[model samples]
Target: MMDSPDSLVYLDGVSKLYATPQGLLPAVRQVTLDVRAGEFYSLLGSSGSGKTTTLRLIGGFEIPDSGRVMLGGEDVTQLPPHRRNLHTVFQNYALFPHLNVAQNIAYPLKIAQLPSAEIKLRVEAALEMFRITGLGERRPAQLSGGQQQRVALARALIGRPKVLLLDEPLSALDAKIREEVRQELRELQRQTNLTFIYVTHDQEEALALSDRVAVMQQGRVEQVGSPREIYDCPASLFVAQFIGKANFLTGRVLQTDPLTVMVQNLPIRASAMGYQPQLDETVTLMIRPEQLQIAESQPDAAPTAVQAATQAAAQLSVNQLSGRVIGDTYVGQLLQVQIETALGRLTATVLGKASLSSEVNLTWLVSACTVIPPALATMPSP
Candidate 1:
């Protein structure tokens, strides 16, 4: 694929391998990505997914076995880290123990051989920009995790690099501080208008902080899109299960137009999105827990078996299912309820409360659920 004209960083068919005791193992395999200028793009995946390796390749710290890494339309795949127009803020903050915060932020400028007076002025401005002006004299050991993170970011941006690469910079901070820093990071990126390529294994962090995210697995990208696209319309089962909580139900395709599938002797209507599944082909249906609506069932109005079957058939036109509550847990403002239905056990995140072992009706629109083909099924055209 051609790189976008506005892309500040472009990875073209990049691949990396490591020589271990077990022999050569691929860490990044034929990955291609384009990060638009001034956009917050993230590489998101668990450990061993090669996200950090990919970031290192971009930073020119790790040489790829094949392909090129381009920054601002110039190939820098073989260049040294200092030669690239980018700086990396590592997970541990990597602050020098002996240097105070001002000196740490000024180190990059010092290395550039700027005038002493200019360096002092820039360091003061950076400290004020990062809200650490009063703590400039404190060493890394004397500061909090969040303060250290600010020092690291200040040091990185002090160089005014074209792109800033972060490798889980907030992972060491406590939850509250992490959130605060995450928001500050986003705001800083917008305020500076600098492109940011962040690497993280935390799905929530990626979804909340990034303008777009690339989901990586086994050294390959599964999907790349906006957070809402990744969460609401995942491209594969892996992505569906990885980004958030999803409930899956397997069924065989009964029809193609306005796609219908049969699950547990009940016909389920689902949206095909862009996928085309053939009749008789088994497919999995996925729905988010929050998409389902649950209500208490009227036990006094319970219908006979035949009437219930008729009602089920009629309800198939929409999406409705009857289930008995098996579990209920309070999570913040929402209630996580698990129910046992004919198809299988499903979890629903709803407001209010639900009693355990009580019959309830679950309803959702056909568009609320997506049809995912089997592993061997052909993927939709790009």
Candidate 2:
């Protein structure tokens, strides 16, 4: 396949395996990716999902068993790390404890055998750019985690590499500090306009920091898209469940036109944007917790009236389900409520709290639900 002209890094059918005692273990399987220049692209997955291995392959730390790695449209599969125009900021920060901040930032320039005056000038600029000008003499052990992170970033960027690779760089900081550093990292990327390939297992971190995210599972890439696209229109059930909290309903297809499914004898309208379910085919519907709206049920309303209202709403491509609130939990700004219906226990997130054992009505738009055909329920390993 031809690499995109804008792609700074391209992986063509890359695969890697490790020789384990159990036998050969596949770490990455025929993964093809195109990372455009000057974009924050993330490799997101849980542990053992090949995200780190893929990063290493691109960084020349690990060579693929098959396929090629392209950097700036040049094949660099067998090149060493220093030969490539890229820098990696690891999880541990990997700062030289013996050296101070300025010395650490100037190490790369010194290695290139640049003039001493130029090295000092660049080191000063890096310290000022990372807001650590006053801490130039502070060692890594004396600095806070966030400060050390910034120093490492300053060092990596001081070399002016074409791309920067980050491996869970904020995993060591506290929640508040991590959030602060994450924003700084994103802003830094934008200011420098350098391409970034970040690897992280945190879903929220990946979503908040990346321009595009590649969701990986069991050594393969399942889906790749913008944060909103990955969340709203997942390619597989794994992607949906991994990205955020999802409520699922199993039902059989009742109609193809505008796609309607029957759950517990109630017609539920769902979006068939990426899936096509045949007549009477068993399928699963996925709706995000935030997409569902809950309201108190009228005490004077009859069961027949509720049923009639549901049917009427279905005709307009809306889904209405009535149930008793079985669980309610206060989660800061949002209240999570679980409803026990005939179909199953469905969870929803609302702004206000609902009392347990109270009857309620749940409604969601047809576009809010994604239909997952059985074939896509579990993606097979490649």
TM-score of each: 0.93, 0.94
Model 2 RMSD, rounded to 1 decimal: 2.6
lDDT of 1 at 108: 92
**lDDT accuracy of residue 343 in candidate 1:** 88
lDDT tens digits, residue span 1-382, model 2: 9888999999998999999999999999989999999999999999999999999999999999998999999999999999999999989999998999999999999989999999999998888888898999999999998899999999899999999999999999989889888899999999999999999999999999999999999889989999998998888888989999999888899999979999878889999986888999988899999998899999796669888887786758778888999998889999999999878898999997799999998989899999864544454344
Clashes of each: 0, 0
Error of 1 at 44 (Å): 0.7
* lDDT values, one for every candidate: 0.91, 0.92
Regions of candidate 1 where Cα sits further than 4 Å from its true position: 302-317, 373-382
Cα lDDT tens digits for candidate 1, 1-382? 7878988999998999999999999999889999999999999999999999999999998999998999999999999998998999999989999999999999999999999999999999999988898998998999988889999999999999999999999999999788888989999999999999999999999999999999999788888999998888888898889998999999899988878989869988888883678999888889999999899899788689999898777665559889999998899999999999998999999999999999999988788788764563453221
In order, what is each prediction's RMSD in angstroms? 3.5, 2.6
Residue 208 lDDT (model 2): 99
- Choose the strongest candidate by lDDT: 2
